[model samples]
Target: MLTHPMPDPIAFQIGPLAVHWYGLMYMLAFILFLVVGRIRLKQAHIAAAGWRYADLEDMLFYGVLGVVLGGRLGEVLFYHPMYYAHNPLEIFAVWKGGMSFHGGFLGVLLALFLWSKKAKRNVLDVYDLIAPLVPLGYACGRIGNFINAELWGRVADPSLPWAMIWPNVDQLPRHPSPIYQALVDGVLAFILLWIYARKARPRLAVGAMYVLMYGCARFFTEYFREPDWVVNVLGWDISAGQVLSIPMILFGIGALYFSYKFDKKAAPTNVAKPKQKHAQ
Candidate 1:
């Protein structure tokens, strides 16, 4: 871990077109998903749903909308409803900052539901296929947060090597919550979900594990994250991230349970077997 005070957000500049690292990170996240998703789709389980490589493009296109719109909306509604109500113009200034992970999660769910209906595909099947590819993008998002240095962490002991002293906050060393999230949510999440999804059995497993795993990671990680300035409630001392993660953990628990219980239902018993399109 080198300490050069986290790089500046700018990637490069083309006259007035100044490219930000945050934006670049999103592009990279999506590319990683595209590359990984294409390979996974060809697997026997995904093939059951007849997802072609082309489908990845269409599906991810919808996801982009979900992430942007839902994230921005979630921030406004969940964290700063009162403030935004006072300053309506700030709601449109997403590039400046403010987005909620839970909101974006909801957005993607809706997008997938619509995509499933239009494609005549089972909703769970698509969810399972897409779950593994999500972590990389999420990781990239955290990296963006780090670069912006907006979502700083709680106060920490100076002896803490990884403790970051965000001048905007106090000089005290503090946990770099974004980095922790990137490791847990981004790196660990991708590895675990990808390995688990290789076979793609039990459609519920993928979506459920995604909720469970990310929720757990996020909930725990939120402990070190600083509270949003907008909400300074007493006693709880918990951040909004932790509150949002609770539902995800619950949903994950339910999903995994059903996946196990219904594992027998999707079996090839009189019901039609999944078609094999790719002979290879």
Candidate 2:
């Protein structure tokens, strides 16, 4: 069994200011989003449609707002409502740590919708473009979680080679869930979605795959993860994360169905239709 290297949460300090690794990770995620977004804009169709740097910047701003607010609320409501309900002010103390992916996802959706409305762009297009970029960012966030020694996984068999001991939680060996999530939900998902998005397939296809892949990854990883709390539903043990992911999977499937059923290709706003040749 490997002992967990519980790195200090604080990355560094400058006199009066303390910089945290988690915050740095988030910043890195945002920066990578811009980089990926630029790559996305390089495509001829996307470039002609005006997927501009300014628009990307604006979307990032809105996404930050959504992530912070939605993550905090989700942590409060979904995981520890009773605790937060009593100490309500702690909810604002994000620096202490607490975030939910599902909440952030919803928050991103809302942000995209608002931005889409203003830009007169289809929200699904924005979603598809952004989806491929998200997993790596998610991977960074999971690294942050690991560094903080937070969200430790469920106890594991002593014989497991990679089983880790988080002294903060207990001396017992536990599944290294954060790493599992990072690889499966972040790296694997990124690869799959990135490959799928490389070529245009159908409207909403990339975004739909993103939702489905992430849902499946999170659900599967939850078995090894220590649940924030377990709910007894229909005589089944379900983690909070799994519960939230279920909706995402269903929504993804529905989106794919609509994309195929409608048989529409996503096109830019100003795309010119081919001129019809009159019969000779």
Candidate 3:
């Protein structure tokens, strides 16, 4: 079994100010959004929809707010509400570390809804446009988690090749779950979404696909990672991540059904039909 490198959290210091890898990772996530968003804007369907760089920039602005606020609140309310409630001031202590993906997901949806209203665009359209751009950025955040060695995985079989031992945790070989998530939830999701989004489908289809992909991916990965908290649902025990994902999975299925059942406008195609007629 291999041992975790346990890299220092701080990336560098500029005079009096110190920068953390975690913060840099967040910055990278935003940058990836812009970079990938630009490429997404070039798609025929997206461009025909009149999305411009200006709109993309504005969406990024709103998305950052959603991610920060939603992630923090999710962590507070979902994970440690009682502690935060007892020490309310600690709620503002974001630098101490606590954020939730599901919370950020909801926050971004709200932010995008507001942006959609301002841009006079359909919220589902906005969601579809943005869905393909998110997973790589998510991978970056998981890398940040790995660097901090904060969310180590459960114990693994000694025979597992890549099984890692987080020195800070214990000597037992453990699945390096962050890397697993980065690969599966982040990279894999991005690949599939990017390919799927390359073609037009019914309205809300892409967005629903993203929700389903993330929910399933998160559920699968949770098995490797240690549970943050467990909830007893009926008689079965489930992790908080799984608990959160259950709704997303259901919503995805429902939305996909709705998209295919009612929204018959979009049919899968690689390119938009040419406006000009050619001589036959």
lDDT of 2 by residue, 108-154 (tens): 88988998999899998888778898998898888888888888999
Alpha carbon lDDT of each predicted model: 0.82, 0.88, 0.91
Regions of candidate 2 where Cα sits further than 4 Å from its true position: 266-280
TM-score of 2: 0.91
Per-residue lDDT of candidate 1, residues 1-280 (tens digit): 2232756668799999888878887788889889988888778877776779888998998888888889889999998899999999999876555668889889988998898898888888788889988988898888888887778887777778777778666677788988889999889988998888877467688889988999999988887888774234585555688778888999899989888888875466687878979877
Which has the better TM-score: candidate 1, or candidate 2? 2
By lDDT, the candidates rank as 3, 2, 1
Q: Model 1 segments beyond 4 Å from truth?
A: 1-7, 229-236, 265-280
Candidate ranking (TM-score, best to worst) = 3, 2, 1
Clashing pairs in 2: none
Q: Per model, how many backbone clashes are there?
A: 0, 0, 0
What TM-score do all the candidates reach, one by one? 0.87, 0.91, 0.91
- Which of candidates 1 and 3 is the stronger one according to TM-score? 3
**Taking the tens digit of each residue's C-alpha lDDT, what string does model 3 give over 1-280?**
8999998888999998888888898899999999999998899988888899998899999999999999999999998899999999998766545678999999999999999999899999999999999999899988988998878899999999999999999999999999999999999999999999997788999999999999999999999998889988799879988999999999999999999988966544467887998899
- What is candidate 2's CA lDDT for residue 25? 84
